[model samples]
Target: MSLIITDECINCDVCEPECPNGAIYQGDEIYEIDPNKCTECVGHFDEPQCQQVCPVDCIPLDPNNVETKEQLMEKFVKLTAKS
Candidate 1:
């Protein structure tokens, strides 16, 4: 359920608005997602909106931060509870 952005990002800022969980952010030079906040859009959408709107398809699964659906739900819970 993890997600990440690759270097293929063009910095076009197209994918930022598509995020439902507010996980995507402009990186120092590329875009990055806070793994703790990314829920793969499980709670808010059927698919990862960021990837769907990305002009370059730079957003992809984060191999290093892989998580299960249960974990993704947990992350969503935590993120919503933080406020």
Candidate 2:
């Protein structure tokens, strides 16, 4: 599943740089995760890097954008190809 940044985000700018897919961005209010670009760091790390660094623990799996691990890997491959 992809990750989502809730209203709890502090906009501390820590999570933005930790996202390997660059899915996290400065939204109008809080940091937003673009599901299209979010692989949950499957291609790059063992766990979601943003979640690890976020102080408020606002990052969570996006149930609305859920995907299987295999599906996430496929998306990661596609994203890697674009680079």
Candidate 3:
């Protein structure tokens, strides 16, 4: 599943840099995760890097954008191809 940054985010500016997929961005009130670009770091790391660095633990799995591991890998490949 992709991740989502909740209102609990402290805007510490830490998670943005940690996201390998560049899915995290500054929203009007908090950091937002773009589900389209999020791969949960499947191609880059065993775990989601954003979740690792967020101090407030505001980033969580997006139930609304859930995907399997294979699907996430496909997304990672597509994103890498664009880069």
Candidate 4:
């Protein structure tokens, strides 16, 4: 699954830099995760890097944008190919 930044986000700015897919960005209120670019760090790391550094732990799996590991890996491949 991709990740979502909740209202609990303090905008610490840590999560934005941690996203390998560049999925995290400053939204009107808080940092938002772009599900289309999010691969949960599948091709880059074992775990979602943003979640690891979010001080408030606001980053969580997006139930609405859920995907299997294989699907995430596929996204990762597609994403990397563009870069």
Of the candidates shown, which would achieve the greatest lDDT relative to the real structure? 2
- The C-alpha local distance difference test score for the whole of candidate 3 amounts to 0.92
Error of 3 at 53 (Å): 0.7
**TM-score of model number 4:** 0.96
Across 4-83, the per-residue lDDT of candidate 4 in tens digits comes to 99999998899898888899999999999999999999989998899899888898899999899999999989888955
Candidate 3 lDDT over residue span 1-83, tens digit each: 89899889999999999888889899998989999999999999999999898888888899899899999999999999955
Q: RMSDs, each prediction?
A: 1.3, 1.1, 1.1, 1.1
* Candidate 2 per-residue C-alpha lDDT over 1-83 given as tens digits, one digit per residue, 9 for 90 to 100: 89999988889999999988889899999999999999989979999999999999999999999899999999999998955
Q: How many backbone clashes does candidate 3 have?
A: 0
TM for every model, in the order presented, reads 0.90, 0.96, 0.95, 0.96
The Cα local distance difference test for each model comes to: 0.85, 0.93, 0.92, 0.92
The total number of steric clashes, by the backbone 3 Å criterion, in model 2 comes to 0
Ranking 1 against 2 by TM-score, winner: 2
lDDT of prediction 4: 0.92
